[model samples]
Target: MKIKLRHLAGKVFLSLILISGLSTPISAQNLISNGDFETWEGISTDTGLDKGIPAGWTSQTGDGNLTLYRTGTPHKGNYSVFARNTSGNVSRMFTPTLQPLSAGKMYKLTFYTRGKGTLANITLTENGEKLNGAVATSPSDKNIFASPSMLNKEYNNGKEWEKQEYTFTIQTDGIYKLIFWPKSTAGTDGETSDYFLLDDIELVEFVDETICTLSEIIVKGSTLKEFDPGILTYNITLAKGAAIPKVTATPADTKASVKITAATKIDGTEPERTTTINVTAADGISTREYKIIFEESNEILREGFASEDRPEKFTYPNKTNWIIDANAAQNNGVFFGNNSIRPKGSDFTDDYFTIDNCTSAGILSFYLKNRGDNANAILTVSYQKTSDSNNWIELKTIPDSEIGTSYEKISLPINSGEPVNIKFHIQKTAGLIGYNIDDISLTPFIATKQENEKTGKDIVFANGNTIHLQTSIPTNYTLYNINGQICTTGNVSGEYTLSVDTAGMYIISLQNANGKSVHKIIIP
Candidate 1:
């Protein structure tokens, strides 16, 4: 049932837009040649200064050295890299050939650092013969940092010089060797006297408009919290024949796609209604959008997800072997990096961590800890009985019985009313070992406010294309659809019309014996 239908052909509406195209490729250059350090060489003519070779670059060990070049402290012209190791060194730097990338594409690097002492870390490798560069710090599977604790600090003790950048993508194509390495944060004693500087260093080829989406959009118990993912517009009032809400969007690059196309009915003459959701990335055409209006209002939505950094939103590009672990956690603190990636280095991955939105959400708790031998770990959920109808049905899995080895607590169920996306997956091969997850949560599905005196508290929303219901008492009213059948019934009190003959989703219940109330509608 899809045709022309622009602006409202008969009427029915919904909202959701998680697009992130990032199209901006008019040109490209910057490969890194001497990057700012302004190029320098020589021993300042026999050690008068200039001791850290910075003219193009290379490093297996310090050849033609001059003290690691600082030239009094230049961030732009003179020179940078102030390094100085001794007690078992490894000072690195490479960048010369490059120019191959292009498979999947994306790039971007930029640089600048500070940390004159303590933990001055940095390190990023390539030269792919197999990628994972054997691991340097964190984030992997293909290009996510890979190690050194997921690298990202620009240091701030030498006072200033921060400026970082990341972007990444370009999985594999060829011609490698990039490595920058900077080190120092481990156990100390790289023979003390360690310093840090580095300079501008750009790198190019980008187009990652970001769009991590689903900032905060609750459903079922309602609560839009002003919706503003950078002014994509989100409104949300509902009441007058209410029922036209289903705005689930979860795309932070899972190949990304939501292309906006949901509008669940309801239109008395339109007080307000809008729809839009066109998230396109993964190289289809680079897009972005998210509208969702729907006004009217009488009130009836409780809202969900409490908040407390909300588990740092789960981690890395938002859920992906969800790293963080901080050595280990069950309650000890840092959680994530699960599916068993233990006592070897810190964490490992196979992938799968999703956790998006979740409206009526019925339970999917967390905290597990299997070690291997296939202890089992997989939980899926994206269901949708009916709210705006995306028909997403996976319902349940939570198998492997419940996994074990250490941590516990694992809840599972998840019925779903609207925004719901939950994944866990865990598989191991090459030797085995996988499991970890903590505090994860979602228990919503309780909306029960209650109020009915006719022109005031809760239930009202009456207009046409039929969706009229008042309520003072009289009770006895039922209208269910979305598969439960029973389209209509009688005996409501102050008002009633609800004929939603076609389009989707509806629920209207009234009670008499002193209490009972419910209203959910949509009929564009």
Candidate 2:
């Protein structure tokens, strides 16, 4: 709890407070063996696998344009993978997996990566994608890969290391392989031969049982503004040695904060003090509340989005670099009145696209309408990150699709924290233009999945400035922003009158007896 002190002439107003991340589970095991390409010691292709490559990994370069070799950059150990693609040929690397992951379970793939130029993607494919036992660099059958939603990828993000994570549900009990392919930008040599560095590739099942993956506990002293609680449960914990459970009345998302005071205490003599943990799914006008019981615990926080690692942001980037043309039928955004243009190309495999960053847990949603040929005006959305950006270990060139002139909604999912540079290519412009777009927008949203027996439940709040805290159970707390910048923090619990002197956005982390709870606040 933080104590805000304001000296006014002679009178002094005193208020008190408590103060914490994305916690790595005490027990997290990577399913992929030798995911870090550090074991390439004297490994040769004398038998079957590729020479000089790490064990349990094989690469294939069709038409000899892409090459997968060892890199000095790594997110973990000293060794990593370097992928370079020149011209327009294809190169793919596959993971050795004679066994199948448990089906019906949720799996998360994460890795750290960076790139110099255009990058391809790392995809999850069926067992047959491998030519017999080794993974094929270019799988002939397009049906071998999983759906777009299940793929975790990475992309180039300057020279810095970025982490990406993707969560998906296993469909069937089949062997899954990871294929890495670095793609050339327009297949022009020296124009943009993309090369990427990857290290510490990991895929794990996210399961945290005994805790709801959507609910969080906040004492009346805490402030939950503009929040959404996915699952509802009441955790009745024994606030040992306190009276009234340190609460006056429940001032949840609906109730006002004025009702909470410091006089209240846990039901000291009541033996079992029920510190009413309220869950709120408030939507401004109305709220839905759920009650949960904690027999012998303090606080609990669970989230599917892992917002601490992934942040949310809204921006209107510079429009000068955007390729705008009359043939493309460009227009301003429906909301901001900003300009938007479609891709222009001529051939079947025309590469008319640019690489841009998508940082956070949300969707790159926009208003789009086809303006070119009815059957040929296609949209090929390829991204690198969790789902599409694990900061940068995976990559994908999503299949193309046709969009008509109905002004439809186009949303491309992005990973939290690990933002990927996306490419919107017009596969078949057909000697014409592409899409008429507007409202180039993005929203940081939560993708919380309630998988039974999951681990590491996360809770992240939107950006704000008002300071409020929950839980009398003491632990460490910290306040930062979406950019990983630390602000203010302390270790205490109670009511606090925060003096957000500056108008800036910040995130508050509360790590108490239960777990860690992160809150984002913007000071205006």
Against the reference, the lDDT scores of all candidates come to: 0.48, 0.46
TM-score of model 1 vs. true structure: 0.24
Question: When superposed on Cα atoms, how far off is each prediction in RMSD?
Answer: 24.0, 31.5
Error of 2 at 200 (Å): 0.9
Worst 10-residue lDDT window for candidate 2 reads 301-310
lDDT of 2: 0.46
- What are the runs in model 1 whose C-alpha is more than 4 Å off? 1-28, 31-33, 36-39, 44-80, 83-109, 112-163, 166-193, 197-200, 203-207, 212-258, 264-278, 282-524
Instruction: Tell me the lDDT of candidate 1.
Output: 0.48
- Model 2, span 1-524: residue lDDT tens: 01123343333322111000121222378777789888874544422323366778776775445555665556667878766555544466668674466666656667766665443445566666434212222223432433332222235465677776654556567777766654453222322224466788877765422222232334333222223456444333321221232332243333222222232334332323333332222222223434323242221111111111111221124322233332213443233122345444443345534344544434444566766355355555555553544434222232224455566655444434655565555454355555654544444433222321154434333225455543445657666544444567777754343556667655555566664444445567
Model 2 residue 67 lDDT? 54
**What C-alpha lDDT, on a 0 to 100 scale, does residue 440 get in candidate 1?**
53
- Model 1 agreement with the true structure over 181-292: per-residue lDDT tens digits: 4443222223222346667776777665443454544433233445565667665544334466555666666655766555555454342366667777656665677777
Residue 88, model 1: lDDT of 30
Which ranges of candidate 2 are over 4 A from the true structure? 1-27, 41-51, 117-119, 130-154, 185-195, 208-524
